[model samples]
Target: MNPLVITVNVKSTVYCDFQLRWYPWDDPHCFLNLKVTNVPSFGLLVDGTSTVTMRPELLEEYEVVECRLQETPHPTNNLTLLVHLTRRYQYHLWTTFLPTSLLAAIGYGTLLLPLEAFAERGSMSLTTLLMFIALYTETNSSLPSTAYLKHIDVWFVFSLIFLTLVINVHLMTFLADSESAGQSVRPTPSRHLTHVSAPPFAKRVRDRMAVPKRILRMSTVLFALVFIIFTLVYFLAIV
Candidate 1:
């Protein structure tokens, strides 16, 4: 009997260039182009490198052998790679993405509050706004402070400030309208009958009717002016 010669591929190595592309709102997707090389123990006829491209659609098929951020260090310019390895991506999702979503939900909660709950509106609005600011600050602490605003940070601040202003406006409008309504319906004291005798029904009717209509008109104008002025001032500061 002749001894059998068994041939086996001992080592397989893969080199891939990954490109991560995503919209501003959505989680990023990665595409990989791999050059798969097969090494054999003994010299064989079939030995070559094959190029394989893997996209997000095909990620489920292959087990990610090794995924890491390839950092190229330079003395002059330190370039940080924002690569997301599959295992480590969850950290960003939880810390950055989920929290931002939660904050926006909290802001929307203010709208559901009853208009009569003036104190609750004021407190909730301010509290949520401050919480947004604190969260944004904490998130940015890990990054460098630069002049240009980041997209997430800008979105957070805009939503927060808008909610805050809206709550404040609602409070002010409720108060002003309440006061105007009260004045419009106020009963006037009669000059005669100092001891407070109920006048005849006709007299009462006449007195009520005599209340100047101009006062109601004036109140409407005043309320509109106040609201306009307040809005102008508030937005001027924000912008």
Candidate 2:
């Protein structure tokens, strides 16, 4: 019977002399068993074509291992291959994922504010959204200029736009409610009601129309329209 022997090799910048053997009968699925004696780094580069140095003694220990042919070349060579395993990839994790998630949380702040406070609280949403935009810009500045959008950038921009629209819509709703109430009652009647005893229903109506509804409604509508048009133009410009 011919003795089953397998050769193993290590290819690296730092000396990584290793040997591998296959034990086909031990594990049916994975017959290859890799072992190294003198190498410092256990990580091996498995690029398709290379003469890898192997210690003969380690191969002799495991006699029945099956060796599989190389499928594809390693995507990158030398130290470039090692970069994939390093902590550098963590930048992608923190920059893109963390800020986008934080922005989404900040967006919920708008919902917490009373709808009546939309006039004053509207700035909070816009400010938070702008803060995210600034963060997105800063994060992007650090990244390499690539044609395709990064995952985090996409999420941040989407959240920014979404929150902007949400704030605008709330403002518009408040303005419309205010304006309708204002138009329903005349200013002359409102002035006279202050002197005479106003009906309970009239008092409620006056309270509701305390805000300058007509001007605000027109302003809100115009703001939304301009914002929408600008957003569309900006998106087109970016694309």
Candidate 3:
């Protein structure tokens, strides 16, 4: 008789089960037993996964469990391998995630630059955005095609979103600063000739010019908070 063969594919870094079953031709008169050869002569496992003698990039290790059942019309013995595989996140956390995170933090650094120096700030924002895109592509290339999202995917997506917000915030501040700078300056009446207090309307205009600065500060704080929260949530959930 030919040997039975089975194949399966895994999508996520989660626990999975693989079953090997055997049934006898005669249930009561004859029975079948099963035994698993951990270290097969043909080399059954490759780097803790059932691969063709070559280590894979993302998977780690597995576990095996066995059981038997007699309630069925045809009694059978089953050997269930409970495979516990984890995404190899150490390298990604260092190379992909760390660089992306640092770029995001540095992206906010542009906010510290002089608002009037639009060229410098705009250049920094554009560079950071490109870095994020490159890192995201590198990370994706390492991963296999899967229908569902993985833990690592969550981190990259959130990081990209944060960077996008930073760029938009800088853009808002830039426009506000430009308009304020171009406004016609109202000359103060000769203080030497007459002691005159500043008009209420003039004070209101000055106060409004400060709004953009306040928005920049608030946005910085918000970005920092969100980045920290995302980092914590992602690591905690995956680990």
Q: Which candidate wins on TM-score?
A: 3
Which is the leading candidate under lDDT?
3
* Residue-pair clash count for candidate 2: 3
TM-score of each model, paired residue for residue: 0.41, 0.45, 0.59
Write candidate 2's Cα lDDT for 134-215 as tens digits. Answer: 8778876765454555444454566676677657666676776666676656554453445664458867665665553443
Give the true-structure RMSD of model 2: 14.7
lDDT winner between candidates 2 and 3? 3
- Once fitted onto the true fold, the runs of candidate 3 whose alpha carbons sit more than 4 angstroms away are 1-78, 185-209
- Displacement of the residue 153 alpha carbon in candidate 3, Å: 1.7
lDDT digits (tens) for residues 103-122 of candidate 1: 65565565555545657756
Arranged by lDDT with the best first, the candidates are 3, 2, 1
lDDT by residue (105-192, candidate 3, tens digit) is: 7897887776556688888988898988987887688665456555566667787787788778878887786666465255655658
Q: lDDT at 55 for candidate 2?
A: 29
lDDT of 3: 0.59
lDDT of 2: 0.51
